[model samples]
Target: MEALIPTPADCEVRSVIKIFNAQSIVPIEIHRQLCRVYGPNVMSKQMVCRWCRQFSAGRQSVHDEKRNGQPSIITDDLVELVREHIMENHRVTIAELSSHVPQISCSLLHEIVMEHLLFRKLCARWVPKQLTPEHKTNAGIVFLHDNARPHTAQRTASLLQEFSWEVFNHPPYSPDLAPSDFHLFLHLKKFLSGERQHFENDREAEMVVTQWFQSQAADFYDTGIQKLVPRYDKCLNFGWDYVEK
Candidate 1:
């Protein structure tokens, strides 16, 4: 008759003991050698070899040098400059940002703006032209963002709290989770670009955007506008760079 296999709980305890006390009673390697010399035994079914090795840990994680990261070549002032341009001009490219804010590498600027300053917090909210069942859900009905500097300001969050509207920011690079980037921005961009003739200045541009949003029909908003979500996803998948013209 075949020997019954040991239960997982028993196997686990035996495995730990094997690692703790490496000698006597047929150490795993000795068992293997015995199997070769004296042939396989019914008791070999409870071999704790693999589990012992796992528990015998000598830094099981991937080995890599903990080299210091690249030197920080970006400044807070530079990140703040990028934020100001974004607030005023609506967009900027890497090249344009480099031009506007000198004394920083493009890559470093990208890193700092994204990592340290959290420049996305500087912009206005992508106000939904029309709310739907889709707009009904958020992390909280009235919440505030975490991460102090790059998130919504305390005063701004307090204002939103009065109206009891949910406020949240997903983790960085989490484009899939945010609805506004996938919906509101696309609709707003299309509307603004279509009425380009009306925008002679930044103020004019913002006003035109507001007017276009206000003018959206319920059917157009509910149907055609929803398609922007997929396009926004595509843009994120392809590239999230903001190109300045």
Candidate 2:
């Protein structure tokens, strides 16, 4: 008797388990290029080629997507938009972003945020002087959060307070908790592909994103909260050095 043969997901996860067991990031361009150039035929030692074949050929149980781009579609404004939506509405998705940005395909919005944006593939953090740790700690923590800042600057603090009741921030390199990493964006990939649908314009995209966000778990904020505690801890323990790449 032989061991039960697993599905494509089993195989893919196994392969990734092997590589990521060691833990590494493969540039998607290199992976996609190998499969695109050599794919329609033949085989090789390239693990990426194998991965591309398994995924693109429908051999894998996981959804197969063919992505090709040396650069990303995300800009500072797009990040700002995603951050704004998540901060205000409690969820953000490709459909929502279509209004903010219409040039991309729905799949791109879904996958691109994970492959590119969340990983800082094209964008970098723009830490404002006001958002720093020192500024944060100086503000009497709770007062800094709700009571203190509003007393100092009622208007500015009020606007911020509206967003904070729902917003949760994750630490750098903590991909597992970020909405783009954990569920929202990935769910969009399954949705757009499974439904064979794509939004044609910004208005349509906004409707889609808004609808998708509404479908998420009420406790969805917990994901970021759990991850952020460690991040905040690391910040306290190491300050600047503890939490950086």
Candidate 3:
């Protein structure tokens, strides 16, 4: 298994130890090594060296020392009160709730609702309960894809019917308007275009593709489907004519 990158706290602690123990390893060297391993966006050299200086002066713990501040007013009672307000009216806005819970700030109240109560409001309403894996499989997933022979096999059709999912078919021969053809496969092909290595076997190719797909940001997949909306509208405008890329 790949070792997990040290958390910011752990890295700070480790940097301190490296400073005193090694006595010659510099902050820039440490920063360069960390960036190469973990990517270039981790903590700065200044922070690492600052911690090193503190530790060299005999500071021990890696954990942050407490600073003087007004203690947060939010308590268990306030959290419960916020929960009650949300439960009483699922449609209640955070601004409106702030008026009732004058002690808590709107940001704090929002955090309590989201983090503490584990509730999310969408479009002025509480989000629907999340579906279980079984629910998701049985709740009729609308599968839209290229009409490959395997996908259109009698067994596949029967399975879809049993699961109550309806397959939406695009107009015949309009591959440009087919969401999978125009969006998914197109992007996948482009992504693979820059690769120079040739896979020795199907398993190797599958592993490479799986890793590449997993590395993609969530927005990348969402954007693939989002791109279909305009194509669909254009197809409709052209009276189901073949839409251009």
Candidate 4:
């Protein structure tokens, strides 16, 4: 019989076997070896350690242990089915998606949309979580968010007055006027979509958000703010009528 070549996963199992026999080599050392051959991004350090621990506990199976669930009916085919509808129209609603993929429950479809495809609904429009404080020191600073009591409080108004930061009037039922609603958040949501990274806490999320902001070129933000002008023009033209742009 011809000798069989080992797959990457097979090599990982073999490495684990070697580490077990040696009774001394740590996971970090094996990780270094794998990195030398496959590059650093091949697998996470956490996964390597997990495999090592499993091997130590006499769990010889290289394959994943069977997970307890509804047997994971969400296959790649199902994911592609959902993805096609989303790609055709990024703003497609969950209810609309359910129509196309009737087999998938609303909640499972929601997980596929938010966690797998990296999309979120903002004012009924599908977008990415792409916010950044890049232009903080710029002469013009406009804060636009939903009208809430705390936001309109006297203390908040005083703070804005002190900083000379203008608060754009986000009228009732008008998401188009807000740059965040129509532009910033839409862009942000897209940027974060389909990304596999996860944050353990608020501090990590903040750090990642800040890092994403720092990575953007100045024009990215300039274009977002500039879009507000045309929206403002539309609002004026309609005499403050509900403009859905």
Sorted on lDDT, highest at the top, how do the candidates line up? 4, 3, 1, 2
TM-score on alpha carbons, each prediction: 0.27, 0.25, 0.41, 0.38
* lDDT for each candidate structure: 0.48, 0.44, 0.64, 0.65
Model 4 lDDT tens row, 146-174: 66788788998999889987666665555
> Which residue segments of model 3 deviate by more than 4 Å?
1-139, 147-153
Highest lDDT among the candidates is held by which one?
4
Scored by TM-score, the top model is 3
Error of 3 at 125 (Å): 23
| Candidate 3 CA-lDDT value | 0.64
lDDT of 3 by residue, 135-217 (tens): 34433454665556887789998998998875765655455755557766777788778776688999999998888889889
In the predicted model 3, the residue pairs found to clash are none
| lDDT by residue for model 1 (39-70), tens | 45422422333333433553232212243687
Q: List the residue pairs that clash in candidate 4.
A: 118-194, 128-188, 128-189, 128-190, 129-188, 129-189, 130-188, 130-189
Task: Evaluate model 1: give its TM-score.
Answer: 0.27
- Give per-residue lDDT, candidate 4, residue 209: 77
Give the per-residue lDDT digits (tens) of candidate 2, residues 117-212.
Answer: 342211122122122232243222221121233333767656657755322343343334333444456667787788887789999978987887
Error of 2 at 166 (Å): 12
RMSD (CA, Å), candidate 2 to true, equals 21.9
* Whole-model lDDT, model 1: 0.48
